[model samples]
Target: MINKVQILSVTLPGNLDAYIRIANLWPMLSIEEEKSLTQRLRYNSDLDAAKKLILSHLRFVIHISRNYSGYGLPQADLIQEGNIGLMKAVRRFNPEIGVRLVSFAVHWIKSEIHEYVLRNWRIVKVATTKSQRKLFFNLRKTKKRLGWFNEEEIKIVAKELGVSSKDVREMESRMAAQDVTFNPLPEEDFVDGKNNNTIQYLQDKTSNFACRVEKDNWEEHATNKLSNALLGLDKRSRDIIYARWLDKNQKNTLQTIANNYGISAERVRQLEKNAMKKLRIAIEA
Candidate 1:
């Protein structure tokens, strides 16, 4: 049995160096040892078997965490998330899966870290759709230059990631943009010639009051315009727009709505487009 205290005591000075050292220590289990341990956990619900499997794979998690350091998250936190993923993989692993534990565990580990990166990388999530997630990962690998992807590169990425070219371009634009703080700079507004932090800059009473009033006025005008525009719409058109666009879980698609009204899908599309254009113009006016 490996000494838990001894392993805990061997902390390398730096995170990357620590992970590298841990990677070198990943133990190789024989075929019989691997099969026996997996069976014990899978069939017998053996806690000890699960612990042994997790303990042996800690080094692999460390190795995997090193690859994600470029995402700018804390190394220790990434390693911890990877460890949690490793445990999940161990729990769900089937002995009949006919693959090594390490191979199956890699997906789980990376999934956990990828989720962490997406959630924390920006104030809002960078990758929300399936295509965006594919682009998010592949873009990191396929990118060779600092600027946007060219036409040829976009085609290549779309084919490689199994997404449309338009999706690839949109995701590329999103990845290139950086998140900026909403508040103003400290040096831009100073009192008594004293320097202030961003927190202090936000404390300016006049600026905060003006911003709140502006936002309130905008919302009031927008709401009133929307009400007026909807009133101008015929009853059926208003119902269709409300059902398809405003409802939380409405079950009306263009084809469904067309069938209900004995109209073609093209006609439905045209109506929907005209309605949207009118709504936009009304709100802006």
Candidate 2:
């Protein structure tokens, strides 16, 4: 058996092509040989056997890591993370289960790459739910063929991806949206670094300021119309309406207004109701 310490001392090539060549040159172990090494490491804590098992499996991690390079992360870092996951899988592998290590370790390998992509992709997380995650990873492939999804395309994608049409539309909007700076510049500020441009941090597309302002303006206009409608009521009706809603304290109810005006509660309620109808009509008009 090769000495574990000596194996660690030797520098492994970082380049993928060279590592692939080295892994290809390693002679494939028979089942009996693999089982024997696994037993020695598992029972006797034999470091040399564990080292051999890990070295033989390095090629599989490299191959799997290549598929995740589309996420714009460094290829070398992705492979390194995949290698860590491979080591973890090797430690937990049970040769008695009658499965190849590659098959079992593929899950572990992809899991690590997925975590890496999520962590580095944005300052804010993109996907939290399982369905959203599947959409996040697979939606790119579905959208690659066309410019954007039509209604028919959205339905097909939703069925194929196992998500709701609403969820697919949400993810589509998220993907199409670009992150803008919180304090976006006028193109002149970027020419020189004098601007304290730290607000160039990532902006949340879901909370657009323009949309919020528009909503606020609409609410303010509706409130003004309501105030105007109340002013058109008779003095007593208007007083009763103000006491019910706009008074700061000791807000008068129908009984309280009736006591103040020496009228029955039913009469006070009638006046309030009629005032409300007139206000609604005025606002509608």
For each candidate, give its TM-score against the true structure.
Answer: 0.58, 0.58
lDDT by residue for model 1 (1-285), tens: 223311232233466666666656657678788889999888887777777787788788888988888778889878877877887788878889799898999999999888888988778788997668867977877774534678997998789788899988888787778875555465555557755334544556556777899999999988788889988888877877886888888658889989989999888888888888888887777
Q: Count the backbone clashes (under 3 Å) in each candidate.
A: 0, 0
Tens-digit lDDT string for candidate 2 (31-55): 7888888778767768777778777
Off by over 4 Å in 2: 1-20, 181-285
The candidate scoring highest on lDDT is 2
Check candidate 1 and list the clashing pairs: none
lDDT of each: 0.78, 0.79
Taking all chains together, the TM-score of candidate 2 against the true structure is 0.58
